[model samples]
Structure formats: C-alpha cells, structure tokens
Target: MEIVIINSSPRKNGNTAQLCDAFIKGAMQTLPKPKVTTVFLNDLKFKGCQSCFACKLKDSKRYGKCSLNDELSPILSAVNKADCLVLASPIYLMDVNSSAKAFLERLCFSLGSYEVGYRSLAPKEVIVVTIYTMNTTIEYSPVGAMDNVDAFLGHIFSTPRRLCAYNTYQFQDYSKYVVDVFDETEKLKYRDKEFPKDLLRAYDLGRDIATRL
Candidate 1:
C-alpha cells in the first residue's frame, strides 16, 4: 500500500515531528511494509491558489491543475497516487501552520473541477495528525482544531480519520508570551511521559487504515 505523509511543521525536530516519527515507526513494524513518502512543507516552495479559474479551462493541458507551478505539482501527483494521506501539523495560532494552509488551498484547487464537487480527483483514505500545546480540557484547545481539518478532509476524501495530541503546555508560567525560552529537559520529560500514548494511538489508526487498504 502507498501512504503519503505531509509534515507541515516548520521546526524540524520539534515535538510534532517527533510524534510523527514514532507513529511512522509503528507503521513500519506491520507486515507487507507499506510504501511511505513524507513531504515536509517547510522545505517546499509553493503558493496558495489565486482563484484564477485557469484550471477550469477546457483544451488546456493544465486543466484540473494549479497554474502557478512550483514544487506542489510532484507532491500533489504523489498524493493522488497514494492509497492514504496523512496530514501532520503543529498547531499555530489555534490552527494549522501557514505552510499547511497554503498547501491545502493549492491542493484543493488542483484536485477540484468546476463541474463537480470538491472531491479528490482520486478517492483515498485520509488521516490527520495535530500536535499542540494547549490544554485539552479548554474549549478552544487542540481538539477544537479538528473542526478545520474535518472540513478540509470531508471535502476531499470518502473516508477520513484523525489523531490529536494536546496538553503540551508544560511551561509553568504562561504569564508572558515569550515562546523563545523553553526548557529542553522539561520538554523531554514530558515527551517521555506523555507522547508515547498519543503515538500509540496514531499507530493504531495507521494500522486500521492499512488493514482496510
């Protein structure tokens, strides 16, 4: 089976990427060893769709494809060929990171046609992975971000699922807005203590999709 994993976090080895790695490790342990391709959005060059409607033109070679060509074409092509898509992002400002949003917008434009609904050109299973520092008990925490992902995935996939991680707010003092200063030891402690549980959940989700595929 083919699976495309999109990592949208700007920080290379941050908490979100670490969790994704764990989940991927678990998936690799399964039999048949699914073919997995991971694309890091921060490393790519791409822009959002401008709604030029150029993709709708008939007799155009670029029909159903974004006109503003960049690094997205190859990635989108791989996504179309994959059996499952994994969207992983670190929550920024209570939502997905800017790179992830731009990728999604351009992808939506490329995969959608004017005559039909916003269905993926190639039907596929979808799974979303979101990591955030907000407490889960709060109303507008990491879990709330799922709504945005759901709206996007529901439009693109016939079957969509999700896995989320919250409560990374290990910092004792939230009085200041300085995110620059973080305690690495504390972060590692938190990861060692809490991240494994979430990673296991994501692994199970991946296995479930693999079984169906």
Candidate 2:
C-alpha cells in the first residue's frame, strides 16, 4: 500500500517535521515495503481557495479540482492516489499554520464538492499530527488544536480512521513568565530530554494506522 505525508512546517527539521519523520519511520518498520511519500508545503507555491465554485460547474470535467495551475496539482494528485494520508503541522496561535490552513482550504474547496461522486478518490485513512510549544499541563491546549483537525478530517474523509497529536511544552521562551521556573535554554533542554518520548508516541500512532490499513 501507499501512504502520503504532507508536512506543513515552515521551519525545516523543526519539531513538527521531526514528529512526522518518526511516524514515517514506524510505519516503514511495520509494513517493511509500503511506498511512502513525504511532501513539504514550504517548497510548493499554491494559493488558498478562492471560492469560485468553478470546480463544481456542471460542464467542468475537473470539478472538485483546483483550476489554478500550480505546484499543488501534483501534490493533490498524489493525495488522490495514496491509500492513507498524514497531515503534520506546527500549531500557530492555537491553530494550523498558515501554509497548512491554505492547503486545507484548497483541498476542501476542490474535493468537498465532488466527494460523493468521487468517493474512491479520497484517502481511506487520515492521521493528523500537531506540535506546539505550550505547557502540556493545560488540559485544553493540545486538544483544542487537534479537535479542529479532526473536524476538518471528518468533512473530507468518508472513513477517517485516526488522529494523533503531539505537544512539547516548555520548549522555548519559558522565562517570560514571572512564576515560571524554567528559562528559555532550560526549556530547550527539556525538549531535548523529552524528544524520544514524543517520538515514541508518534511512532505508535503510525504503526496503528498501518495495521488498520
């Protein structure tokens, strides 16, 4: 089977990318021969959905497909062919990153309209990965962002299988708060210490999806 991973982190090799890599690694170990492709959004040039509704035109053969000719066409084509899809991004301001949001808007606008007729084109399973620098103790900090992704997946995928989110707290700028005990460098150290644990969870999520597939 084939799996496609869309990485939307602006920072190359950042926490989000690391988690995605770990997940891919685990998936590879499980399947041993599954074809996996990772697409980085930073390298692509694509605009957000314009809400033209042209994709749904009765005469349009490319309905539910973006008319704008750009780099995203190939990526979307890959998504259409993949058996499973993984969306990985770093949370910005408690939501998806701008690139990730733009990609979703385009995908939703293009694919949402034709979902019924083109059900087979949709990915059978979807996995979401979100990385943040917020405190992990906050009950709602991570789930808040993950819920948004889950809702998005529910709209796009007919059989959305699983969702996974990983959050790293105290990773940066811990000194801003007066009551905080960890400093910026200390927060970085903590992240370094906790990286393995975070990666292990991500790996498990990947393996779980592979098993279901």
Candidate 3:
C-alpha cells in the first residue's frame, strides 16, 4: 500500500511537519507496513493549474490527469495512486497556506470531470486526512474556512478526516521576533501542554486509519 503525505508549510521542522512525522511513525508500526512518501511543497517549483482544460478533453491522452510538467507533476501522479493521502499545512491568513492552496487547485481540478453531474475522474477513492496548525485559537478561527477545499477533496476522493493544532507556538525565542500580539509565556505554556496531545492524536488517527484499511 502507498501512503502519500504533502507538507505545505515552508518550515520543514515546524509544527505541521512534526504532526506529519507523528502520523508516519504510527502508520509505520502497523502490520504489513505501507510505503510512505513525504513531499514538501516549499521545496518544489510549481504553480496552480493553468486552466488549460486538457484534463477535460474527452479524447486527450492526459484526460483525468494534470498536464502540467513541473516538480509537482510526479507528486500529483503519486497522490492519484495512493491508498491514503495526508495534507498538512499551517494556516495562513485564516486558511491553508499558499502552497497547499496551489497544490489542491491542480490536484482537484484535474481529477474533477466536467460531466453533467460534475463527477470525479479519480482513479480510485483514496482515504484523505488534513492537518492544520495555526496561531489562532479555535473559537476565533473563521467558520467554514476550509469547507470549499474539503468539498473538492471529498468529491474527488473521500471526505477528509481533520486534525488541528490551534494557538501554536510560532517562534522558538519570541524575543527575536518583533511581534507583540501574543504573550510568549502563554504560547510556551500552551505548546508545552497541548501540542503533545495533538501529536498523540495525529498518531492515533494514522494508526487507526491504516489498520482499518
């Protein structure tokens, strides 16, 4: 089995990446372990779908696949063939970061058909999971911020199971940054207390999903 993880956060060792690691660790412990691939979007050079409509053409050889030939092409292909997919990103401006947004646009648009029902042309129904890390508290988060993205993924694959870490610690030494919006003491306390729980939850989510599959 193939499990693909997309890390859209620019910080490779940040909270978002840590959660992805935890998930992978749990998945690797399962019986009959699956092959896992982690792709860091920040390390790739790519853009969103170009609206070329090549994937929609009935007679096109690339129908139901993204035709963009770039660093993201092979990653998209792998996602299409994956048994499970995990998208991890840090929320920026109340939504997923730019890399995640761009990746989703290409992946979802290509697999979505322009048929009467707007059906999905995906090769298979892959299990989907989304992990979000943000500085905003859960109560202050924008409602329905990810509804549209989730809808697209759900149509193309399975409805995604969501995991979130809110009010995350943003800086290692808050003194270095010129930000005073948040209390550094509180942030540290929360990170020391709650972040570990989030990691544990991520691990549980991965193991449960892998075992069930």
TM-score of each: 0.79, 0.78, 0.97
For model 2, residues 29-141, the per-residue Cα lDDT tens digits are: 78888888888899999887777787778867777677777898788777766777777777667777788888887776676655555442244444433434334434656
Q: After superposition, how far is residue 50 of candidate 2 from its true place, in Å?
A: 2.0
Model 1 CA lDDT for position 62: 76
Lowest lDDT 10-residue stretch of candidate 1: 128-137
What is the lDDT of every predicted structure here?
A: 0.68, 0.68, 0.90
Poorly placed runs, candidate 2 (over 4 Å) = 114-137, 140-142, 158-182, 185-189
lDDT of 1 by residue, 120-180 (tens): 6544454443334333334557555667666666666643566667656444454455655
User: Mind giving the per-residue lDDT tens digits that candidate 3 earns over 1-213?
Assistant: 899999999999999999999998888778356899999999999999899988888888989888899999999999999999999989899889899999999999999998989999999999999899999999976447667777888999999988989999888899999987899988899999999999999998888878856
- TM-score (C-alpha) between model 2 and the true structure: 0.78
Ten contiguous residues with the weakest lDDT in model 2: 128-137
Q: How many backbone clashes does candidate 2 have?
A: 0
Error of 3 at 8 (Å): 0.2
RMSD of each: 4.1, 4.0, 1.1
